[model samples]
Target: MDTLCSRMLLFLGLAPFMTLAATPPPTHQFTLDNGLQVLIREDHRAPLVTSHLWFKVGSADEAPGQTGLSHVLEHMLYKGSGKTCADEASRILESIGAEENAFTTQDVTGYHQTLAPRYLGVVFELMADLMSTARLHADDLAREIAVIREERILRTDDNVDAAALEHFTALAHFANSYRTPTIGWMHDLQRVDAGELRHWYESRYAPGNAVLVIVGDVTLAQVQPLAERYFGVLQKRPVPRLLRPVELQLPGERHLTLHRDVATPQLLMAFNLPGLATAKDPHTVHALRLLNALLGGADSARLPKKLELTERVLNHVETRYDERTRGDSLLLLSAELTDPPQADLDEVQARIWQEIEALRSTPPSLDELERARTRLIAQQVYARDSIAKQARELATFQTIGLPWRLLDEDARALAKVTPQDIREAASTWLTRERLSVVHVQKGGGR
Candidate 1:
C-alpha cells in the first residue's frame, strides 16, 4: 500500500483481505431496474464516505492468450470516459480532495474512492460514466500495455520469490486458467489489442455483473435516489458467472526446486484445503482457521519456534490462506533462509514435513488451541476499528458469491473447534499425498 504498490496494489497478492469477525456488518441492499445491485451502510462517525464498484470477473474468467485483460481494463477505466479527458478523473477527484484507487483479484476487480459525504454524487456519476462509456482508445491501450508489461517484469521476472510462488500455485492445481498470472503473461500482454479489451469490457462490465458498495455518513433513502439516477438506466443483461472447476486431488506429493542465481534460498509449501464459503463441512473451515493461526498467523507460532529459535535453521517465515476464495483454498507456508550457517537446505526441508506430521499425530493441547482461537477473534474485533476495512470486507464477501452473514457465521463456527477438530483438519486436509513443495536455491547466473 505504498506510493507505487498502492496504485498497482493488486499485484502484491496481500496476505488476505478481511478478518473473520463475530459482529456482522450492518448493510442495506437494493437492486436497480437494470439489475445493478447496491449495498450501503450509514456510518455517521465522520462526514466521509468510501464508494466502491466491484465487477464479478477476474483472472479465472480469462481464456488462454487473453490473460490480464481484466486488470488492463481496470487501468483503462481510470484513464477516462466520455467527456472526461485522459487522466481527468483523477484531476476531478483531486479537486474534491478525494482518494481514489483500484485493484484486481482472482475473483473480482474493484475501484474505490474515499471523500466527503457531500461529494457522493460526484463519485457515483463518475463511476457510472466510466462503466458505461469508457473510451478504449488505441493509443491509450498501447501506453497502458507498456506500463503493465513493466509491472509484470518488475513483479515477476526479476523477482525470484514471486516467480516461485506463481509457478508453485499453477503446478499445485491439476489444470485451469488460475495457473496464469493476474497481471498476465508477457507474451499475451504484448498481443492484447484495444479490440480485445473493448470486447471483454462490453461483455463483462454490465450492470447485472456489478455491485455498488457505499459506506459513510449517508442514509439509504438519500443514497438510493442517487444510485438509481446515476446507475439505474444502464442496459440489463445476465452476468456470465464462471462455472468454477473442481480441483482434482494431486495423486502424490508434487515438488519443484529452482536453481538460479539468488542471494538466499527460499522454501514454499502449499496444501489445498477447504474454503469457508464453499466447503461442504462447516467445521473444516473453522478448524483450518485456528490451525493457520496456530502455525504461521502469529509471531509466536510453530514455524518461528521450531525453525528459528529452537532448531535455529531459518529466520523468515509466513503462512497464508484464503478460505473464501472463489476456487479451492491453498494453505501456504513460505520461508527465506537465514545467513549465518545453521542447517543445510535438505535438513530444513525434512524438518518442515516433520512439523506437519507432529500436528496430525498429536493434537495440540487445549491451552494452545484456545490461545489461537482467542487471538483470531481478537483480530477480527479490531478489524472493525477501521471503517474502510469493514466496508471492503462486506464488498469482498458479497462479490465473491458469499452472503454477508458469513462474517458472524465464521466467527461462531470457530468457537466450536476443539483440539480434536484441529487434529482432524491436519490429518484430513494437510495430506502428504497432496502437498506441493518448491525451493529456490542459489546458482551462478543473473
Candidate 2:
C-alpha cells in the first residue's frame, strides 16, 4: 500500500491540475421562487464565462408510448424561439464569438454557452427564450426529423459496435427505460408528430425542473443580477416527479449472441450492479472503480497484460462500469478476439470467466489497489480544469438525486477502498445468473 500510494503521489505531482490546493472550489447556490436551482462558481483566471442549463427530464421520464420524446424535444428546442429564427440563435452566438451546444442522455438534457464576459447577457437571453418560448414550426420539424434519422443511420445502422451495444442495452434491462436508445427506436421516431413534440416540450421543459450553472471569470454579484433579469421572469409549472420502474431481479444467467458482419469478433460481458445512488454501501462504488482500473482501465491493467501480452488471445480489451442515474447499473467487459481456430473460442471464454472469478475469490495486490486509487484521483483533478466538464459533473450529480458534493467525496472514497471490499462486491453482484454475454461474429446475419 505504501509503495502504491507513493507512486500515486509522484504521478500526481507531475500531472496537470494535481495541485488541488490552488484550485478554487465551487460554492454558490440559489433557488428562484418558481423552483429553478442556480449554482455559480467564481473563477477569475480567464476572461470568459460558461453558462449551463440542465433539465431533469430525460428518456426515463418520457411517456410510455413516447420512447424518444425527450431526445426529439432536444432537437426541437433549437428550431426557433420568440424573436430568434431557426438558425438565428447560432448566428447570434457566433456574432459574439461564443460557442453553444446541447445534448440529451438517459437521465438529463443540457445546454451550454461559453463566451467572453461581455456576451453573458446575450447567452442568458438566448437560453431563456429557447427554454420558455420555443415555437416549433411544422416544416422545421419535418426537416429536423429527417436530419435526426440520417444521424441514426450513420451512427448506429452502419456501425457494428454501436448496433451491438444498442441491442445489448435493450435486452439487458427488461422493465427499465434505459433499455431504449436515446435517439429512440426508428419506428417510434417515424410516428412522432409536431404536436406530440410540442406537448413534450411544454410538459418537461418547465423552469421548475431546470438548474442554471455558471462557471468562470465572474462573481455571484455580477452574474446573479443578470440571471434574474433574463431567467427570473419565466413562469413555473407543476413539474411531475420522475417515476422509475422496478427492474426484476435476475434469476439466472442470460446469454445473447448478436451476429453482425464486421472485421473482427467482439465479445461483451455485462453484470448487473447497484448504482452509486443506491448501492448497499457507498464503499462498493469506490471498490468497483478500483477494480475496473486494475482490470481494464489502464494500459498496464490485468486483462490487457494477460490477453494482449501473455495469452495473445485478444488484440484489444477494455472494461466500463456505468454508475447511471438509475439504481441499476452494469459492468461491461469487451474484447476483440485474435484470429484463431474455431476450437479456441471456448478457451477464450474460459479465460475471461476465470479472471472474473479470480476477482471474487482473491483481492487485488497492494500495488494494483494503490495505482487504481491514484489514477482515479488524478482523473477527478483533471476534470476540474475544464469549465464544461465541471458543469457536467455538477449537473450529473444533482440530476441523479445525489449530493453534488459527492463528486469530491467519491474521489476521496476511492483512496480509502480496501482489497476486501472489492472481493465482497464482486461476489455479491457479479454472479453467473446476473450476467449477460454478447458475441458479435462476422458474416453472421441477425
Candidate 3:
C-alpha cells in the first residue's frame, strides 16, 4: 500500500497534497431562519479558511436570448454593491492578502474566497451585501459585457476544439438545457442589459436558493454566529425551478464534423448518461464513474495504453464523467491525433469502439478493477488537502440536491462495483443511440 501511494504521488503529481493515511475532517450542516443552508467542515491544520457561496442558478436556467446573463452577473457582482463600490470588495480582500474568484456553470454560480480565519466575518459581510443589495449599475454591466465578449472569442470562437465542443453540445441534446453554452451565445451577450441582469439576480440569488460552505481552521460555533449575523437577516424569497423540456431518447447516433485551421485533427465522443439527480438506479452512477476511470483515468488506462503506446494512432486520450449534476451528465472521450498523423479518423474510431467492445463482452480482472478504484480513491483523498476544494465539493453535492455525506460513501460504493458492474454499465450506457461523435478536421474558411 505504501509503494502504491508513492507511485501515485509521483505519477499523478499529487505529492504536495498527499497526506497518505490521514482521514478527512468532519462536516456539519445547518439552515438559517431565512432558509439559507450552511455547511462547515472543521480543518485545523492551518489558520486559513475558504468559503463558497453557491447559488442554484446558472446558464441552463436562462431563457433563450438571455444566455450568459448569469456569468455576466457574476462579473458585475465584483463591480460594486451598496457597501462596496467599483471593485472595492476585491480591493478589501486583496488588502488582507486573500484570494477571491467566482465561476458560472450549467447549474450553479459560485463565489469563493480564501483568507485568514479572522477575516471570515469580513468575507461574509461583503458577500451578503452582494447577494441581496447588489448595485447592478448599467455602466458596470456594459463594461463587463465587453470583457465577456472577448472571453467568448478567446475561449470558444477562435479556439477550434472549444468551438467544436460547443457545436457538439448543441447537436447532442434536443430539449436539455445542457445544449446551451455557459458563456452564452455571442448575440445574446450583445442584447443582455442591466435590467435583465438585475431581474435574473433578484429572481435567482436568494437565501432559500443559496448554500454557504466553509472549510478550514473554523468550528461550527464560530461560523454559525457570523453566518446568522450577516446572512441570516436577509428575507427568503421563492426561487422556483426553471421548467425545462425533458430530453427524449431519440434513436440513431448524432454526428458533427467541424472544419477548423488546426495542426492536428481531434475526435470527441460523448454519451448522455444519468447523473446523481437523474439516475433511477443509484448504483449506475458509481459504476459509470469506475468504467470511465478504467477506460482513460490515467496513463495506464486502456485507451492510453492501446491507442497512444501500442497502436501509435493518437497522441492523447481522456475520458470525463461527472455524476454530480442537477441534469443528465455527459461521459466524454476526447483524443488528439499524433504529430505527423498516424491513422485516419475512421480507423481511429473503429479502434476506439473495439476497446469499448472488449469491456462490454468480457469483464475486467479483479486486479484491474481494484487498481481503478485505488486511483479514484487516491484522487479524492488528495482533494481534501485544499480547503477551497473541500468546500466546493460540499457545496456542489448539497446544491445538486444530494447530501454532502455522499462524499464519504463514494469510495465504498466504488469498491463494491464489481467487474460485472463495469461490463453492464458499458453495455447499457455506451450505445449508439446515446453517443454523439464530433470530428474536428484540418481546414479553413468553413
In model 1, pairs of residues that clash are none
Can you write out model 2's per-residue Cα lDDT over 190-295, one digit (the tens) per residue? Answer: 8888898888788778888888888888888888898899889999788977655345677357677777986778888787766887686778877887788877
lDDT of 1 by residue, 73-160 (tens): 9989867788598889889999999988999977889989899988989988888989989999999999999999999989988887
Task: State every prediction's TM-score relative to the real structure.
Answer: 0.92, 0.93, 0.94
Encode model 3's per-residue lDDT on 79-105: one tens digit a residue: 777898888999999998889999999
lDDT of 3 at 138: 91
Of 1 and 3, the candidate ahead on TM-score is 3
Q: Which residue pairs collide in model 2, if any?
A: 252-433, 253-433
**In model 2, how large is the Cα lDDT of residue 184?**
83
RMSD of each: 7.8, 2.6, 3.8
